[model samples]
Target: MYIEKIQSPANLKQLDLKALKVVADETRKAVLNRVSKHGGHVGPNLGFVEATVALHYVFNTPTDKLVFDVSHQSYPHKVLTGRVSGFLGDMEAMDAVSGYSSPTECPEYDNFEVGHTSTSVSLATGLQKARDIRGTKENIVVVIGDGSLSGGEAFEGMDEASELGTGIIIIVNDNEMSIAENHGGIYKNLRALRESKGTCEHNWFKAWGFEYKYLEEGNDVEKLIEVFRSVKDTDKPTIVHIHTEKGHGFAPAVENKEAWHYSMPFNVENGSSLEGPEHESYDQLLSDWMLQEMKKDKTLIAVTSGTPTAAGFTAEKRKQAGKQHVDVGIAEEQAAAMVSGMAKGGLRPVWTVVSTFLQRAYDQIAQDLCINSNPAVINVTGGGVLWMNDITHICLFDIPMLCSIPNLIYLAPTTCEEYFAMLRWAILQDKKPIAIRIPTNGVNHTTEAVDAAYGYEPKYKMVHRGSKVAIIAAGSFYQKGENVVRLLADKGIDATLINPRYLNAVDADTLDSLMTDHQLVVTLEDGCKDGGFGERIASYYGPTEMKVLVGGVKKDLYDRFDLQQLLSDNRLLDEQIVEDVMRSL
Candidate 1:
C-alpha cells in the first residue's frame, strides 16, 4: 500500500527517515521475494538498495540520468523511477523490466542494456559529454560495481571523465565479485584500501585526475544520503566508495558471498535455498582437467579475465593447478596476448571464458593468437538465451561467424563427458587458437574423458528418423529441438532430427543428402539467426528449390517474449515450418 502511494522520487523524498527506512526494507523484501521465486541477480541489487534510494531521493531522475553498470542491479532503480510493478512478476518481467537496463525495449530503462560486466562508466561518460555539448543541464550519475572496475571499459571511461573534469557522480558500489570472486591485481589494491584505515593510498582514480571520496560504510543510509547531497553540486568527476555486504541481511549469502551471489527458489525464513549436490561447473572441470594434464604434461598454464568463478575455477585450484594460473584483471585483450606468449614459451595456456564474454577478445583471438597459431584452449560456457533473462544477444553466433578465418579451429560437445575429452584433445594437440564454444552442459561427466582425437561432427548429426521433414539443431538448444521431434511424432508426423554437434564444422555429405531427400530442412541454433551456421548453410544451397526454414533467435531478443510467441515471431513452429515447406514443395 505504501509502495503504491509513492509514485515518484519527489514523493519518496517527502517520506520521513522512519518511513524511508521502512520503504527501503519493504523494497528489499519485495525484490528478494520476486527474484527468489524465479532466480535473478540478488546480491548486487540487494547491496545497492539503500544507496540507490538515497541517490534518486536526493537527485532528479528522467531529467537527471542515472546509469547502472551492467544494469543487473537496476531493479531498485526501476521501482523508484516510475516503475512500481517493474520488479514484480519474474515470469512476466521478460517482456517488461529486463534483468539488465534496456532503454530501447522499455521507455523506463536508459540507453544501455547490458549484462556483461563493466562498460557503464564509458557509456555514462559519453552521454555526459554529449549533454554538455548540447548545453543540456542534467545530472549524470553512473553506478559502477567494484567488480566492473577491473574492466578496461570502466577505466577508460573513468580516465576520460577525469580529463573532461565534468560534474558527474561515479558511485562505486563495492560489494566485490564479477559472477564469482573477482581475480587480478586491482582486487588486491581494493582490499588494501578497505583495510588500510585510509592509509593505503594506492590512488588508481586520482592518477586519472578524478576527485575521490571513500566511504566504506554503505549500509548506513543516512550517511550515504549526506555524501550524495555533498557531491550534488560539485563541478568535477567524483568517486564515492560505498561499501555494503552483498546479500546483506541474508546470512547465507554474506558468509559465502561468492556462491550466494545469485540463487534459485528457497525458504526465505531460514535463508536457505533448495538443497542440491555440487555438480561441477565448466571452470571447475577445466581446473581439474588442467591439474590432471599438468601431472602428465608439465607445460600447462591457465588464464582468465576477472571471471574465474563463472568458469568454476576456485581460488585454491588456480593456485594449486599448474605451472601458472594467470588472472589478468578485467582486461580480456591483455589475457589474449598473454596466452600467445605462454604458447611461444613452450607452455600450453588455456583461457576459459563464457561464450558471450569472449566477443571482447575477438581481435586478439584473430591477430595475436590465431595469426601466430597459438595453442590456447578458450573454454566458453553459458551459450544460449534459454532462460527468461534474455538481456541481450550474448549468443555465440559470432564465434562460428569468425570461421571464415584461416587457422582457428572450433569445437562443441553434447554432454559433460565430452568436455574433458575435448579439453585433453585441445591441450595435447598443436593447432592455431582453438575456441571451444561450450553449452552449459558441455560433456557427460560420468565417463573419464582422455585425450583421443576425434573428427568434428556435422552441425546436425541425425540421431532419429521419420517419414516427414528433417529437423536440424545446433548448440545447447538440441535438447529443445529434440523434444519437438517427439512432439511432432505424437501428432503422427514422424520426422528425422539431427544435432549439429559441431556448429562451425558442417558435415558436407550428411547435409547434402538431407537437403536433397528431406521435404524440409528446419535449422535451429541458440545464437543470432543472421551470420549463424544455419544462414551460412542456407546460403550454401545457393538458389536451391528445396524449402529450408531456419529458427533460433533473430538478433536481439525484444522486451516481451513467450515460447510460443517467440516461435511465432520466428516462424519456428511445426505448422509454420511445414507450411513454408509446402509452399516450397
Candidate 2:
C-alpha cells in the first residue's frame, strides 16, 4: 500500500501529487478501520487526512515544527509519520498510540502532548520566539480549526503572532463544527469568507494583521500541497483558511457529524456502535430534570462551553431549551463569567461542564461566582477516575479546587436521587455558588428523597453508628463505606459509616460527637489525598482524641492506571480499608 511505503515525512516528500493522493485514500481507510474496531476520533481524523499528507509533503517536520490545536486531527498525521501500524495493523498496535498527539510517543514527530482546544497558536508562538532567541530559521506552523478561534487564548496568540513579523504559518482548518455545530459570530464571518472566496470586506484574520490565503478545495491533495508550499518559507505570519468537510469519506459520519466527532467502537459496514446501550448517565438525569424544571420556571438557564453534548444538552434539547440554553464555544472562562452574570441578574444559571475543562475558569469561579455569592449551579460531570484514562482529562482535582473557594457549596451526591435533589436545591436557593460532583459509576437510585430544604448548613448523614471505628465516606465513595461495614461485620467488628454529602465544610457538630464514641475516624474520598475532602476531616480531628486516617489517591499525576489497581493502591477497596482499619486499631 502507498501508506506502508511511506515511513516518514522524508519518504512522503519523495511521492508525487498522485502518489500522495493514493496515500491519503489509504490513510483514511486505515483510520476508518481502526476507529470502527477500537473507538477514537473519527471525523476530525478523516477530514484532515489529505491535509496532513499535503503538510508532510510540503514542510520538513521535526526541524520545521507543526503544532495541531487540540490534536484531535493528529490521527492522520500519526499514520503518515512512521506510525501506520498504529491504525492499519491489529487492535494492539492501535492501543500503542494515543488518540491525541503526544511528545512522549515521538518527540520529533509530535512536538506537544495536547488534548485541549485553542492552544496551538500560543504554543507555536512560543516555539517561534524560542527559535528567534537562538537565531534559528525553522518554520513554525499551527493548524487550528475555525471552532477554536472563539477561544480568548487563540486571539491572544494571534495578536502576539502578528507582532513576531516572520516564520509563522497559521492553518485554519474550517470544518464548521466544534464537537457539535459551531457557536458564536466568528462562524458567520467564516461562512462569509468561504462564500466570498476569502475576499470579504470584514475579514477577522486580515483585521488581526495576518497575510490571509484561502483554499476552497482543502480535501484536494494537490491544492493543499500548493497552498502549504507557498507558505513554507514565508517571512511573515500568514493564515491559510481552508474549507474542509468533517467526516469527508464516510457516509454515516458525514450525515451525523456530531455523533461521529468522537466515537465508540462501531460496525464498519453500517457505522452502528459495537458497544451496548448507554446506561442512564448523570448527564441524562440532569437534562431530563432540567427540562421538567424549565417548564415550571422560565428564569432557569442551561450553559455549556463548546461541549454541549458532554453535558447531555444535545441538539434536540438545546432547541427545546430555546433561548435558555447557552453554548460559549471553547470559552470556559467566558462561560463561567457569563453564568455568574446571569445569576447576578436574578436568573437561575446552571453551567454543566466536565471537571477538567472547568479548571480553566478557576479564577472566574472564585471571583465572579463565589465572591459575589451568585447562586449559579456548576454541575461537574466526569469526576474522579474514569474508563477513558488520559492524564489531561483526569478530574481528580475538582474537589480540592472547588471546596477551597469560600461561599461555594461543593456537594458530593452518592445516588441519582441525591444528585437530582441537590440540583433542585442548588437551583431554588439564592444563597451561594453550588457545585455538584457527578458520580462516575452508573445510576444508583434510592427510594428515600433527599432533603429539598438542604441549605448552607454542613449536615452529614450518619448511616450507621458504632464505637471504636467510624468511616466518613465522601460522595460516591459512600458505597465503599457500605462495603467496609459489611467486611467489618464479617469480622464481627461493628463500624460506624457516615456519608459526608458536603465537601466544602465538615459537619463540626457531628464530627465532635464522633470523638465521644469513636477512637479511629477514617475519611474516604475518591480524589487526591492532598488539599481534598479527606484532608479537611483529618485536619478537623487533628487536635481531638480521635485518630483520623485519610484514604484517597496519592497527590500525583497517574496516567492510564488500571481502575481496580488504583482503588487497591489507595486502600479504596473494602478488604484494603478493612486491613487498614485493623492495623489502625
Q: Give the best candidate by TM-score.
A: 2
Error of 2 at 216 (Å): 0.9
Tell me the tens digit of each residue's lDDT in model 2 across 1-585: 988877889998777777888898999999998899888898988999999988888888878999999888999999888888988888788788788878888788898888888899999999989998999888898999888888889999999999987779999999989898888888899999999999999999888889999999999999998999888888888999999999999999899999899998999999988999778787777788888889899999999998897778888998999988899999999988898999989999999998888888999999987898888999888878763577666778889998888888999989988888888888888888899988887788898767776769889988788878998987778888888888988888898989889999989999988877789988988787799998898888778777888988887766657799888878787888899989988
List where candidate 2 sits over 4 angstroms from the true fold: none
lDDT of each: 0.71, 0.87
CA-only RMSD, every prediction: 4.0, 1.2
How much is 53 displaced in model 2, in angstroms?
A: 0.2
The TM-scores of all predictions, comma-separated, are 0.85, 0.98
Error of 2 at 579 (Å): 1.3
What are the per-residue Cα lDDT tens digits for candidate 1 across 401-508? 556555776766655665566677777777566767666533444443333575534334567766557777765656657767776666667778876656665677
Sequence-dependent TM-score of model 2: 0.98
